[model samples]
Structures are given as structure tokens and as C-alpha cells.
Target: MFRAIRLPRRTLLTTAAAGVVISSGLDREKLPIYPTPNPPILLVDSPSSLEQQIGVARRTVVGTYDNAYSKVQDVVSNWIGVEKAVENRIKSLHDPTEPLTPSLLYVGVATLSSTIFTRTRSLPTRFLLPPTFLVLSLNYFLPKTSTNISTYLTSLEETYLPSVAEKHAIGRAHTAMTWERIKDFTQESREKFGEGVRDAVKNVEGWTGLKLGETLRVQKSEAVEVVVGVTKKVEEKVEEAVAKSFVEEKTAVDKPKEVPVKRLV
Candidate 1:
């Protein structure tokens, strides 16, 4: 048999508590050690330098201008294309053609009509003959006439249109100048009118020995009092007249009407 050694109660409790603490610490150390996530990396962009910012702004402005220039170039090219097409079409219509055959035929028809008009005694025949000749002449001359008109118009455009444009420009400038003068005159008139009004007010003040505003206010108050008094008198007179008329009507109603009696003889 082993000999039992007696220990103090406090000593036994201390030993048990130490044993429990040691066991718990060992258990915690055995637990899976999860690594703590590194603080989230904040990737902050560095602020742009002044020169870089200026460069960016310059590029943006240049890009906008370039885009506008390209758009204008496209519009101008399209306009030029349309103008060329129209010019080509007009040139095709004005191209020269053989006119000899048509001219000879027209002359023959005209001569025959003129001879018939002179030889024929019939008035209707003569009348018809002149119209026939006229129609034939027009048919022959219309093309030449159109060509000549076109040439005249072209010459007019080149010579007179510029002068007309210049005259229009001059007229516009004159109009602008006239408008400016009118505006100046109106401004001066307004200033003069203001001054005249001020002088008139001063003159009125000197004559009346009162400020214009105060004088007007006084006159207004006096007029209002007069109007009010007149209105009150009119109202009293109306009431008295109405009351008298009502009393007369009541007296008339109260009086009995006399019955008419005819005496028979």
C-alpha cells in the first residue's frame, strides 16, 4: 500500500486550476490558425500634374476643332458636288445640234403661207395663213432665241450681278448706319425728355412752393374729400327724394277712388 500524503485544500484547488489553464492554452494552440487578411490595398491614382492637365485640355480642344473642320469640309465638298452636277446637266441641255434641215423646212412652209395669204381673197383663209406662218416662224426661231437668251443671262450674271451685290451691300451698310443714327436720336430724345420733365417739375415746384409729389398728394387728398362730400350729399338727397316719393305713393293708395254714377232722367 502506498502512503497517502495530506495536502491543504487551497493547494489542491491551485493545482487543479493550473492544470485546466494549461489544457485550455494547449487546445487553443491546436486550433486551425487562419491567416488574417491583409488590410485591403487602396490603389489611389496620383493626381495629374498641371502640365499634364493642360496637355489633356489642349488635346480636347484640338479634337473638337478638328471634328468641326472635318464636318465643314464634308458639307463644302457635298455642295461643290451638287453644283458640278447641276452645271453638267445645264451644259448637256445647251449642247449644239443640227438646225439646217429644220430651218429649210420652216422657210418653205413660211413662203407657201405668205404666198397663199397674198393670193387668197377669202378673209378666213388669210387669217389662217398668217397664224400658220407665225407658228412656223416660232418653231424655227425658238431654239436660237433660247440660246441667245441664255448667253445674255450668262453675260448679265458676270457683269451686273456683282454690281447689284455691291449695291445691296452698300444699302445694308447705309441701313445699319441709319438704324444707329435712329437709336442715337431716340436716346438723345429720351435724355432730353427726362431733362425737360425734371425742369418742368422744378418750375412747377417754384411756382407752387411745394414739391411735385407732395403737391399732387395734397390735390389728390383734397379732390377725394370733395368727391366724398359730394357723393354723401347726393346720397342724402336721393334718400330724401325716395322717401318723399314713397310717402306720396302711400297716400295715393290710401285714398279711395270715387265711383262714377250716371243719373238717368
Candidate 2:
């Protein structure tokens, strides 16, 4: 009798427990991976994979920069013929083929002209700052400045670097602007994108619109061709988040491998 009663009770307990689990609507096997409500597409533990992790990018900053680079190259290449023309006059009077010929001066002048074109390509246009800014920023926002000799090198940027304050000021301003531009990536994702970002981006778009951020793409609907023209010094962790930000329907910015820099002659 006792055995029969105990067996029935145990069976009942087991059934009740199973029912409770289902009633609670809990899936023991599944748990949310991202803490943030709007997380990036891919999460990389290592920095090397950041570039590889770039998700289904709807747009890329490199495109605009790349176009700029190509345009500048064409301009410089055209000047090469001018240099040859200048040399032609000298070639007529002397053996221009000779290395020591006076035509060498013409060659030098042409070379210098091309160098200027390169310089123009290097500088930030109305659209953006050149890669030099990123190099400077990486040096500026050092995770540990005094850790190595590089620290001293970056420190020198503060002293010898031209327009340090100017660049930083522009950088900070651009950063403020970018936060807002990012918000527009996800419709109704405004809250998910964050707070200060919305205001900053809205203001930036109001001031610069799509014209400034015209790195990867351009649209007529946008007030300007570019968006917030920012060059941030993204750390390793941040890079991972950014890389995975793309989705099939939703879009995000594509980080470029090389940042542009413009220096004086």
C-alpha cells in the first residue's frame, strides 16, 4: 500500500514541476547576449578582427575618401604632362636626356607641383579631416600615455603639432555632431541610439546636413552631401561594436582602415 501511494505522489510532483516550468514561460537554453538594447552586429573580443567584423555595411566612410583620393590622383597625373612641357623647352637647347641637363630643373618643378596635389588630397575638405587627425587622435587619447616611448612621440604632438587646439576643437565639435547622425541609422531606434546623440546629430544635420558626412554616399534628400564629418580615435573595444553595427535592413557607418592627413609644405 505504501509503495503504491509513494509512486503516485512522486509522479504527481514530477508532472507539477514540468507544468510550472512551462507556465512561467522561461526558455532555459536562451538568454540575451547583449546588455545594450541596441547592440552592434558582431562582438569581437580581439582587435585584429574588428575590420573583418564589419557587418553588412549599408554605407562606408572609405568611399568618399577613396573618391577624393582618385580625383586628386587624376589632377596630379595631368600636371605630369605640364612638367614634360616645361622640360621640352630646355630639351631643345640642351641634351635633356642627360641627368645633369638644365631640363632637370623643369623635372624638379613638376615633381614639386605634384607634391602640392598630394598635399591637397591629404587635407580635410569641407567634408572631413584627413587621416592625419586619426593618427593624432590615437596618439592624443592614449590608453596609457606613459607606458612607452610612443608616449613621448604623442606628447610632442601637443608641442610641435600645428593647430593642436584647432584640430581638437574641431574634433570635439565633430564628435558631438556624429553622435546625432548615428541616431538616424535606426528608425524609431532613437532611444536605443542614446540621449545626447539625438540632440547633437539633429543640430549637426541642421548646420552641416548630409553634405559634410559625404564620405561613403550622397543623397539629394539630404541637405548636404555629407553628414557629421568626424574623425574619432576609436579604441579596440569600440571598433568591435562599430564593425558589427550593420544589418540587412538597417545601416551603419563603415570605418576606414586609413585616416587622411593634411600637412603644410
Candidate 3:
């Protein structure tokens, strides 16, 4: 019955890669085990799992510290790009007699703030500082000098302290902006993977005539258990192999070597 339902190959691969490949048609005991691919798909059964996967993803994408620093630079560059775009649009209006208004500056700032700050929250505070500096520079609120920026921020240190700023460098406005963007991104992602999950569940539901949600919950549990069991076995095998190799080496080193004695007679 499960074989009858066809899912998009890409979607199936995605679900499988997430370590949630649901298979109600086959017995759990009979499932064939195989080595997970290099850079194994994370089974995010809990919040900790999700956090672990996200950290791995950040390290992979950001690469070296220099690269991460460059990414922050790029964020500033993008803000400059927006500024250029806004300036060009204003010039296109071709009113030489008109002054370049704060209205244009406001538009540029809005675009910059939305795009720059809306980037994933996983980015480190240090990385955000570069773009934050650029925002202040472009807005003419502050000179983009490293020292001045540092000094100004230090003055605001009291705000960042436990007494005021909290652990993050965010303010009420930033909190609002970040949450808005996070909501939008989360909703979009949910609708995406949710469709795939729902479709898979529906296929099983058709076979068993069970409700979609209940079938999904069952499949999710089964998949998590299968993935965890497989992972544990793999880890155990690796540890055993390492221990055996160490023992063999130690024995080889400790064994007495037969040396031929030269008889003086």
C-alpha cells in the first residue's frame, strides 16, 4: 500500500535526509541498515538536536573566521548597494532644482534595516557589528570610524550590562524586527516541509484509514527511533574498532623480539 503512493523524488530525498524517513509498510525489525553519508543528516527530534544541527550548518557555511568576517563586510556592502539604488532612483526623477531629501535617506535606511537585520539570528554578535557600523555610517548618525563606533557602543555598555542591556545587544525595536523576520521565515519553512510531511502521512493514512495527524506522529516516532538506534550501533562499532586496534598495537610493541645470539666460541 505504501508503494502505491508516489512522492516527488526531491521531497522524498529531503525527508530522508532529515532522518525522518517514515515507512509504516515495512516492519521496523526488517529494515536494512546502511552507513549514513558523510556529513550525516541530522535527526532533529528535539530542540537540542535542532541547535546542534544549526551550529554545524553555520560552521560549514561560514567557513573560517576570515570568511565570516568577510560576510559581515558583505552585509555592509549590501547596505551600500541599497543606498546606491535609492540614489539612482532619485536621480532618475531628473529634478535638478530639487534637493536630495531626507525622504530618500529614510527609504534607504528602511531597506537597509530590513535586509541587514532580518538575516538569520544564528549570526554572532561580532558579525553583526560590521553591518551595524555601516548602518550608522550610511544613516549619517555616526562616523563609521572603528574607534568612534567602539567608543559610542561602549558608552551604551551600561545598556548591554546585566543591569540593562541583557545578554544580547538588541533593543526593543530590534527585538520586534528580528521576531517579525523570524516569524516570516519560520512560517515559510513550515509550509514547505509541512507539505512533504503531510503528504507522506496522508499516504500512510490511506493505507490504515487513520487520521493524518495521528499517523504522522506515529511515523515521526518510528523514524526517530530507527535513526537513533542506527546511530548508536555505528558509534559502538567505531569505538570497538578503535579499542581493538589500540590493543593490537600495544601487544605488538610489548612482545619480546627473537634476536639471534652471536656465539664468541
Each model's lDDT: 0.79, 0.56, 0.71
Say which prediction, candidate 1 or candidate 3, comes out ahead on lDDT: 1
Error of 3 at 208 (Å): 10
Candidate 3 residue spans exceeding 4 A from truth: 1-214
How far residue 207's Cα lies from its native spot in candidate 3, in Å, is 14
Cα misplacement distance, residue 256 of candidate 1 (Å): 99
Q: Give the range where candidate 1 is weakest over 10 consecutive residues by summed lDDT.
A: 91-100
> What is candidate 3's lDDT per residue for 1-265, written digit by digit as tens?
3667778899988987666445543457574588756886888665688899999989887688778799999999999999999788545533454344653465467657655665765557546655665565544532233344454465577655655544444575688899999999999999989898888878878898879787558899999999999999999999999999999999999999999999998
Model 1 alpha-carbon drift over 4 Å, by segment: 3-42, 95-265
TM-score of each: 0.27, 0.16, 0.28
User: Rank order by TM-score, top first?
Assistant: 3, 1, 2
Model 2 C-alpha lDDT per residue in residues 1-265, reported as the tens digit of each score = 4564455778999999999999677766567787757656987676455555563242366777789999999999989988998677444434323344434354455545555556657444422433344334433443232134344444566778857856865896899888777766564576656555656666787887654334323453343423332223345557767666645225433544576788989
Model 1, span 171-222: residue lDDT tens:
8799999999999999999999988987898898889877896776689899
Worst 10 residues of 2 by lDDT: 138-147
Find the candidate with the highest lDDT and give its number: 1
Error of 3 at 102 (Å): 43
